[model samples]
Target: MIFSRITEVLTHVGVITLLILLAVTLVYYPEFRLVVFLTFIMVITLTVYISRRAARKPPKLFDVIADEVRRGSILFEVDDDEVSRLLEKDFTLYEEFRKQSYKALLESVIIVPIFLWYFIYFYLILPRFVITDLNLRLIAYIIGFVVPYILYLASELVFRVKTLTYVLRGYEVYDRGIVSSSQYIVIKFPLSKDYLVREYSNRKCVELSRKHGRYTVRFLLYTKNTPKLTETLSNYGKAEVISS
Candidate 1:
């Protein structure tokens, strides 16, 4: 905990120092304003990418690995129907995991081409104001807009789809708690009073929650052997089971 706090503090200090340097350069060196701005945006984007990647990295082997060696007894694998029921029951909680609706599909279809056109229009006009030579202006436009747009697209494709798939398809159950996947990470929740459990009417399914910082992480697990699953959880973690 102390190490984590120190690292967080250092991260903040570094970012603040970088910003101050950028500000100083922009104010004192007008000739390099464009370069400074580009550097600023690149740094910001790279920081975001690194932070997100770190957040999505998996935990320790014991917590996240799917190995046969010391795999602790397999409790259950969450199935499609179970996932569907959970989504149907508490969609607001897991809306991002749901399949894309027609409205969203339509919006994407409409917005992407329009965004491209907008970028193209600006790319054509903005450079003329700054650069006198046609070739140099085109090169500047490529550097400023085209590269960033491609990077944006690549990041979206790499991160978002994997995250969506993990949320929708990856869940595992063990004796103590549940293990679920997110983006490129696997999270383990230990069963305890601290974790909330909701049992549906038939005892075939359960929803569990753990508080992580300010956010609540929840998982739904289903099993054919409902009694055994409940008993195992109760015995291992003494979880308070709430009926829903």
Candidate 2:
């Protein structure tokens, strides 16, 4: 229940911070602050819903990988009841995927707008302010503009290079308790994201089951996760890997 507990803590913190901000706004900018706060609340709700839905249906990349890993006939072709069993244990995995997708999508969508706003505010608005109030440092303005752009680019790169799906199971995403040496390798979904090279198109993937004593990934350099790879290796037991 760590996830539920942490979720509660974060929700509490966010709510409290929002309340404080609202109180400050009421005191400092009573004219239009309430309207802005209402807009913020609406936007936040919409974003959370859209993100949760998108997480349920990741772009083709994760779709392909999840399909392969979840529906693969080799290990996944289980009885209907057994399939349900696999889905037991946790709902946090799905939530984790949803949160990451939301963050990445938000980053992608915000980059351009953020850049444009910065250019307009600093170059047009700030200079006008400087003309009226002589305390504006030109050097500081230049640094601020450059720093934000650099940060935006870096964030974009990080998102592009990061994993589409991340999972934390039992106690941790990498938790390896006495789950019994699974006949089908119950890899907790996120068991090996740092080194997995699965694709995202909900494509079919081959599973290992001592079938000829080998396991493998059929593609190379597909999606981002921590440790990126360009190809599958001859041995997967020793090397880390996972599907979306």
- On lDDT, the candidate that comes out on top is 1
Clashes of each: 0, 13
Give the alpha-carbon lDDT of every model.
0.52, 0.38
Kindly list the per-residue Cα lDDT of model 1 for residues 1-244, writing each as its tens digit: 3565477557645755675566555445659878976786677567555654544453232345534212566565666666666545554444554443433344234335534653464456563576556556545544444444445444444433222122334456665345554423343434445677777646355666665432355555655455665665676557777777
- What is the lDDT, from 0 to 100, of the residue 177 in candidate 1? 44
State the lDDT of candidate 2 residue by residue for 1-244, as single tens digits.
Answer: 3564476457545644554454445445659755845754564445444433433342222212222343422311223343344335335435755776787687657555654655575457755643332223433443433455446445644554233322211110112210112222233333243434433323222122111111121221112222322122213223443445
Whole-structure CA lDDT of model 2: 0.38
Q: State in Å the error of residue 94, model 1.
A: 6.2
Q: What TM-score would candidate 2 get against the native?
A: 0.30
Give the 10-residue window scoring lowest on summed lDDT in candidate 2: 171-180
lDDT of 1 at 86: 52
